[model samples]
Target: MHVIIFSWEYPPRVVGQLAEYVRLLAAELVKNRVDVHVVTYHDFLTGAVEEPDGVKVFRVANPVRTHVGILTWALTLNQEVERAAASIYYQVGKQVALVDVHDWHFIPAAVTLKNAFGLPFAYSVESLEDHRAPPANTPYSMSIKSIEWLGFYEAQRVCVKSEWMRDEIVRIHAVPKGKITVVKPKANSWIRDILAMYKSMAGGAGKN
Candidate 1:
């Protein structure tokens, strides 16, 4: 099956541990014969490249260079992200099976793709604004929370690293327990569990 992964960071763009985590997951998926494509952000680099391990990486840069906060920055960059992902969709003959979003940064783009192209997406919950920010009810934090809520509501599935995170998501977003799956990345069953998640969603709706 073919899949697209959305992340804000990748190799040579490490802002946090999620970058390496996604890198390893994509590589594992490739080893199992899955067509893995990653769409991510870069300051100056803007294009696609095939990695040595057979993963296709598409890097997009934010067109507007200035922003007041993460919200504006992410919102502006999503246009570019959506453009790149759409290009991949048509370039691959519209065979993209699933989109795995690593965090909240790209939820808008993913949701747009889902609505416009019938592509199913999964939200890989790495962190949450409710947990990250000191005051969660601020307008800015609420905006982020709203995006998280939208993602959970739209995704075919929600994958978390632990039971704690799954519980957290349920508590924060009111997401149904059945909609969330606890799959620890790189564990013994990591590949098997993740493959099952992908296969399950891959057979769902997509552009016809």
Candidate 2:
């Protein structure tokens, strides 16, 4: 299966554990004979390269350096993400299986690609704005929540690391329980489980 992964962080640009987590996941997916492509952010080091592990990496830098907050930064950076993913779509003969987005950061780009090219995407929940900033009723927080909601609404499937997180997503976003899958990160069957989800989503591609 061929899949594209979207994450805000990856190896050599670690802000937290998620970067390393995604790196390992990509490598494992490649090990399972899945063609994996990652589009991520790097401030200075930006471009595409094939990692020795057989995972393809595409790093993009934010066009606007200055932003009042992460919302603006991610919004501007998503354009680059969309462009990079689109280029891959064409270069690969438009035969991509599906896009597995790692978080809410690149939801807009995924949504756009889905609508424009019939490429289905799965939303991999890392963290939610509601938990990041409690009482997410304020205008700023609501905007982020709206993006998260969009991802849940548009995604062919939603993945979370735990059952509690899956419940929280259903409670906060009203997503159906069947739509969320609790796939433990780095579990013995982690690669197998995620590949199953990818195949399920890919099977239903262009139906969205």
Candidate 3:
């Protein structure tokens, strides 16, 4: 199976847990013989394209370097990511079976591609914006929450790192219990196995 992943960071561009999480997961997917391609924000240090591991990597420019806050950064970055993804999609002949997005940062791109290509997308919810911010929601925090909710709404399946998170998602977002899954990352477990199970249940929904 082939999977296209959109993230805000990747190896050598690591900003936090998401970069490491995606790197390890995508590498494991490659080890399992899955076609894995990653599209992420290009830092000034890394080139536009490269293949550090077995995974194909594409890096695009982050729209602005100014400090406009997380909301603006995410929005601008998503636009660039979507443009790059569209170019890569047609360039590669659109062999991508599905889009696996990491968080709200990738929502705009993932949703755009899903609509353009009729492919299903999965949301890997690491955390909730509301939970991350202070009790009183500001405009910035609300923007993040809105984007996060939209992502949960659009996903064909939602993968959470823990059962607590799954419950939180259901409670906060009102996503059906059946659609949320607790797919905890484990050193002993193969991401391929988990992904295979997901695909088996996903059926034709994930493919174009």
Q: How many clashes (backbone N, Cα, C below 3 Å) per candidate?
A: 0, 0, 0
Task: Write the number of the candidate with greater lDDT, choosing between 1 and 3.
Answer: 1
> Model 1, 1-208: lDDT tens per residue?
7799999999989998999999999999999999999999999877999999999999999989899999999999999999999999999999999899998999999999999999999999999998899569999999999999999999999999999999999888899999999998758999899999888888777576
Task: Rank all candidate structures by their lDDT, best first, as comma-separated numbers.
Answer: 1, 2, 3
Stretches of candidate 3 off by over 4 Å are 45-48, 206-208
- Model 3 residue pairs with clashes: none
User: Residue by residue across 1-208, what tens digits does model 3's lDDT show?
Assistant: 6688888888778887889999988888888887787888865643345466688887877758895687777788888788767776777787666788888888988888888787778898877886777652888878787888888888888888888999988988899998886776873665754686458544755335
Predicted structure with the largest TM-score when compared to the true one: 1
Root-mean-square deviation of candidate 2: 1.4
Residue 139 alpha-carbon offset, candidate 3, angstroms: 1.3
Of candidate 1, the 10-residue stretch with the lowest lDDT total is: 199-208
| Residue 154 lDDT (model 2) | 95
**Residue 65 lDDT, candidate 1, scale 0-100:** 88
Predicted candidate 2 versus true structure: per-residue lDDT over 52-97, tens digit per residue: 9999999999889999998999999999999999989988888898
Error of 3 at 142 (Å): 1.0
